[model samples]
Target: MELLQLQYFQVVARLEHMTEAARSLHVTQSSLSKTIQRLEEDLGVPLFDRRGRSLRLNTFGRTFLMRVNKALFELEQGRQEICDLSSPDRGSVELAVNTAGTLPAILKKFRGTQPFVHFHVQMLKVEEMHALLERGEVDFCLSSPPIRGDEIECQVMLLDSILVAVPITHPLCDKRSTTIAELKDETFVGLKRGYPTRDITDRICKSEGFVPKHVYEGDEPARLRALVEAEIGIAFVLESSTWGFREGKMKCIQIEQHDFVREIGLSWHKSRYLSKAAMAFRQIATDYFNS
Candidate 1:
């Protein structure tokens, strides 16, 4: 019933362990248990199914947890709004990104204009970015294959060409441009599954009636240059990333197919409120990409 009770419940529901949840909340286990007991009594139903030392959210608990999350989110948004109103020129923007290649330049430009504004950025996978956007947790998401949903407003800011990077000595480098089918037999050095680039390129390969054979699966696309330069495996390189590659070591050949392009965009939950600083950051990002 009390705000403190709801907050404690949220932590407990997330951790699912009394000792761990109590430690996280910085409260004694007995006190946390008493608070949860009081909350369950107030609601006239047990929220979690207990098994010795572990706890699992039951059907009622799952349903109630969703509402609790929304309520807490709204309260936090209200607090942020008040802070923004008091200091319109100085506020934090919580942003999540799928592709990190172009973010540094964009952020540097944003900071140049609004030096006082704070940016809290996270590099997230597509699904993680979507969850944060839907929960009103992030102010905006700069993602490739932009986050899509009925409640989200997504705009494509950059259409980066996806190119196949091969070692300078490789046979493919002899051609000016190549198609996905031609690279089907080549060993690929790609980002792991769940990455937007990996997913987008994977789909393109699938449509070409072949699956890419990945010799090295990594998290950073920049590292692909080293692997390709060593002639270990070729990679699908974003056009933006080709800037860092040494020219004579590797060649980034254009994907002749039209579908082999990455769509990088900014997305946000349409219902979520954007502060002055967040809005300014959004505008700066749009202009930076467009220019």
Candidate 2:
């Protein structure tokens, strides 16, 4: 079968609508239908069951679609590999992280070796990272509270403890360690509920029999730390996050009663393309954390 037929089939299987798939493929409905028919004839079984304007993958279609996806992914990766071999010094690496502030040192270290490499980094909520990886949209994802999926592989770079940051004037500032139980009633300044940090914080607090009262929930770390600096509320922050707040009266207290840890890791799809620059960046990221 032609590669175009396999590509069309993949898109049709995903959209499941003849008109939409045809539009997306920039081909006519009849042409698309004819392509599928030819593919089925070559395969000796119908791949989809037509339902008016929509199509559903039959049992055979489902099995064949999986293999088709893998084949397409590999072909795309091979095409990239051929293109990337010509330009080793100047390549782009697309990476996603749950938080932006966590990667400066690691990125700086990676850039040290590959000065010509460019980064296309995005700060995404952890929930969205897996989908980005699965679709091959990003070469790497530094996920926190690491994602679990058979389609991707993740390596734990570090286990960062979630610490409590409080204003010096607060009662717990002088304490060396505290518990979620002690801080249950305390209001928190953190990211919104969809973030891995927020989710982990809520889970840990729930284990202590209470939920956090978020005084503020926004995407920026500066806001979270600023709120704590103003004594507006305490924050559940990473141990590394407290470094910026350390210059002031903010105290980063360890959570002694619970592990209160987050697993930050490097993740990529099992089948996604990785250029030389991307692979180098990945190795540096892995080494930077492990060292």
Candidate 3:
């Protein structure tokens, strides 16, 4: 009927004596007898045959004992899983990110130091990262900022400036730095509208009193670089995002007229309680960056 009743039936079935089972379970013999009687009454069957000073389990009691033991074992396993999820030494951390530049270092350091914690990293678009955080699908996100919402909390992790990407043969590639006005006549390959990098580019061009004439719009870093190699259009990317530019035909030019810098950071829903794994990751990330 109930878990306690099932447990009493199991113990009495095993010991084959009401007094012995109650003594083993730390209960009174009368209480244990009453519990077993209630269980048998609820099931509409006798669980044991009582002879003179002896008890033996009936045929139905053997089958029911097997099922009850299985249920009790599964219940105990579920309780242990919940305890592991709450413990700092044995929980999982789910992190979402739009860019990969800063993630590798953090992952390497955290894994090395806290080997007990497991990590689940999701490579997603800026919009996807925000939506996942809002829905509580991820614990936190590492992304470029100007992430606006009253329900979100953000901290500036690092500062990065914009770089102008152009093919080596292009005329602007020879310059060490370029202004927004100087890039007005150039064709641009921009990130999609929803991304933070694209927003930064738009803000910079607007400050210079012009909207960029985009020849292509995409979010794939590789494709953006390929378009630059074809001399199709220049692109604005973070300085760190140009890590492999020297291997390709493209060169990076620092943008000088406006600050055009973005703060990369971790963001999460303001009201969500962070799991132990997530909290440890936040502390490790902050220390690694600050150091």
TM-score of each prediction: 0.88, 0.82, 0.60
Residue 75 lDDT, candidate 1, scale 0-100: 93
- Top-lDDT candidate index: 1
* Every candidate's lDDT: 0.88, 0.84, 0.80
Q: What TM-score does candidate 2 get on C-alpha atoms?
A: 0.82
**lDDT (Cα, 0-100) at 76 in candidate 1:** 80
Q: What is the C-alpha lDDT profile of model 3 across 1-291, one tens digit per residue?
A: 899998788778878988899899999988988898899999999888889757899898888887886676556545545756767587777788876777888889888877888889997877778876654556689887725467788977878788889898999877899888898888899888867778888987888888999989886766888898898998887876765546569888888868878788889877555766677789988987687
Question: Which ten residues in a row are the worst by lDDT in model 3?
Answer: 72-81
Higher-ranked by TM-score: 1 or 2: 1
The best candidate in terms of TM-score = 1
Q: Candidate 1, residue 207: CA error in Å?
A: 4.1
Give lDDT: candidate 2, residue 48. Answer: 89
Whichever of 1 and 3 has more lDDT, that candidate is: 1
Clashing pairs in 3: none
lDDT, candidate 1, equals 0.88
- What candidate 2 gets wrong by more than 4 Å, as runs, is 17-38, 41-44, 90-92, 104-112, 115-119, 122-128, 131-138, 148-151, 247-249, 270-273
